[model samples]
Structure formats: structure tokens, C-alpha cells
Target: MYWEDFLHVTAAAVENTVSSKRVDQFKEALGFHGIPAGHVPPTFVRTFSFGDIKGLTWPDAGMIHAEQEYDYYRPLVPEETLFCSQRIDKVVRKTGRSGEMAFIYLTQTGKDSAEQTVFISRRVLVWKAAGQRSEGVPE
Candidate 1:
């Protein structure tokens, strides 16, 4: 569909819990010591953020992650439960040598049991027009 139609749309909230084991494993994998500043492991951002968008229909042509950023409002503790939701902030279309492309801007936010925001992750996804080929991008 049209990019404009998806703007401002929000997905359902999903609940997740921080696992100490996973956090420790992530830190060990990256050679980091104890959770610094009480922040959740970086990996948690991606692992827990996508649940809200699972019901959305994505283009079959595939997509590329163009950019991503995270904003932390407060430190998270192990075993803390969070309710996360995703929203489509904006969608823009442009033409390039490859073909028409859509830039989808999304924000995923997490809130703690007390409903205080813990973190927000923003991402930009590039979806190429169907049947178009780009160098380094498999058709």
C-alpha cells in the first residue's frame, strides 16, 4: 500500500521481561562487565522491540535497515517487566537509480510496570520497489 496510509499508525503493546542470564551472556559476548549504569543489554533493544509489528504486512521484495538509534530515559533492572509498543512515525517515498524506495520511520517505546518510559528505539527501513534491483541487494 500507500506510505501515507501507514503514518501515525500504532501497534499493539507487548510485554517482555529482562532476563539476567541473557543480559550476562550478551555482556560476556561483547567483553563487557556488569551492567553499567543499570542499563539493559544492547541486544534487548532489537529482541524485544519487534513484537508489536509482527502482525503488519511487509513488502515481499524485502527491506534494508538504514539507520537506528536508542534513547534511554531510565536504567532498567534485571527481571523488570516492560510493555513495549511500536508506532509508525512517518513514511516517505523517493526515486533513485534502483527504483522507487520507501523510507519507513518507526519508534518503539518501552514502559515499566509503573508506566514510566524506560527506553525508545527509532529505526529507518528502506523498502525498494518491487522487481527493482540494486547492487549488493539480492533480487
Candidate 2:
């Protein structure tokens, strides 16, 4: 249901980190004001790095049903650094109700170009099975 990298990418590369103009484009896309007066929205940041992805599939299909939870290293995160993240790691399988599930965890670390960790992000992915056919809590 979620891409693990989202956690990492979200925390790492926010709108300001990307571009203010792009942020507006992102806001338009997300139905937001693109204003920085408030907290930086994670969803917009994720979208900036990785375009619109309705779902995850093969090649990146490893993250199906993830249980892992990630957090930004608060101490390192407040610095505000550039971020880059990828699929990183994953675990895939089939479940009784969900059919196929993979748990993928992504790690992202931001640096100040001096190669120091300015921020860190970890994310989990819960890949929904193909042919699920319906949108309800799998029984």
C-alpha cells in the first residue's frame, strides 16, 4: 500500500529542497496552496522526487506487505539537507487474505555536501497483490 522509500524520500527531499516553482506545481497537483508558511508537506516532496505512482509492481514488486516502520533521525534531520532515496531493500511473499505481500524498507540519508548525515529517513512498503479486484480490508 505504501512504498518504503516514501518515508525516506519524504523526510529527505522536501519541496524547498527541490524547487519553489516545482513546489507550486506540486501544490497544484495535490490541491494545496504551495505556501511555506506552514509545515512542509511530505506527500508533495515524495511526488517531486518520484513522479505519480498509482501502485508498485514487478521489478519493484518485492515490497508487498511490509510491517517495518521508519522514522527520520530527528537530531540529524533538522539541518535541512538534500536527499535521495531508492527502493533499497525488500521482502516479498503471499498471504492468506492479501494474496501476495512484500515488506520493503528504504533508507535515505541527507548530507550537507561535506558527506555528513544531515537527515535520515526509513520507509516501509505494503505491496497489494495483483488482481485484488476490490478495495476493502482483505478478510
Candidate 3:
């Protein structure tokens, strides 16, 4: 299968409920004494972002997370339910020191119960085909 086949593909929407305990655990793990009122940690959305990559088959042996960006429309509140979905936005191929690599761009979005967009997370993942030499590895 070609990379083009994955472009624009969307995963099924999933619902996530922000639990106060989970938030507290996250805060504690990160050494945050407290957060601003009415807002969960921005990185908390990572709990839902993985749902975006489900059901996609990659031709590569593994992938590296190259970049991540998040656009927040509003503060995410603890105890709020969010509906999240992910889509493959674009795919680009390039020759790198490791050999040929594929850059997969994906967007994951979260919406509130009221259907307003809460956040959009964009990610870039780098992948090398099976058997491709990695950087600095002797052939």
C-alpha cells in the first residue's frame, strides 16, 4: 500500500472523561503543586491523542515522534467529557541520513459536550521502512 492511501483517513471518534483523580495523579507526577483554577494541564490531552493512530498500518518497523503542537480554543476542565477524533493530514517522503523516511502528519481534535472545539493537536512522526539502515549504524 502507498502512503497516499493513508492521507485524509480518519479514526472513529472516542469519548474521554477527565477524571479528577487522573488529573491529580498527573499533576503529582509532574511535580505541579497546583494548577490554575478551571484548567487541566495542557499536556493532559495526550491521554486522548493516541486514539488517533489506531487502526493504521505502517510499512515501517517503528516510528519516532518528531514534533507535536497543540492549539487550545479553551481551557480543558477537569470532569468534562470530550469527544476526540484523529485524521491523517499529509504524508511526505524524504531521503535522510538513515535512508528513506516517511513523515506522517496527523491532526487530533477534541470537542466539548456542547460540540465546541476544545483543542487541536498536530503531530509529525518519522518512519523508516523495514530493513532500512538507521543513522550512524554500520551497514
Q: What are the per-residue Cα lDDT tens digits for candidate 1 across 20-78?
A: 77777777778887646456665566767545443356655568899999899876788
Q: How would you encode candidate 2's per-residue C-alpha lDDT over 69-126 as one tens digit per residue? A: 3344433222244544344454434465746664555554444445554444456656
Q: TM-score for all predictions?
A: 0.79, 0.46, 0.82
Which candidate achieves the best lDDT against the true structure?
3
Clashes of each: 0, 7, 0
Using TM-score as the measure, the top candidate is 3
A best-first ranking of the candidates according to their TM-score comes to 3, 1, 2
> lDDT of all predictions, in order shown?
0.74, 0.44, 0.77
Question: Whose lDDT is higher: candidate 2's or candidate 3's?
Answer: 3
Which scores higher on TM-score, 1 or 2?
A: 1
Clashes of 3: 0
Q: Candidate 3 regions off by >4 Å?
A: 36-38, 49-55, 58-61, 130-139
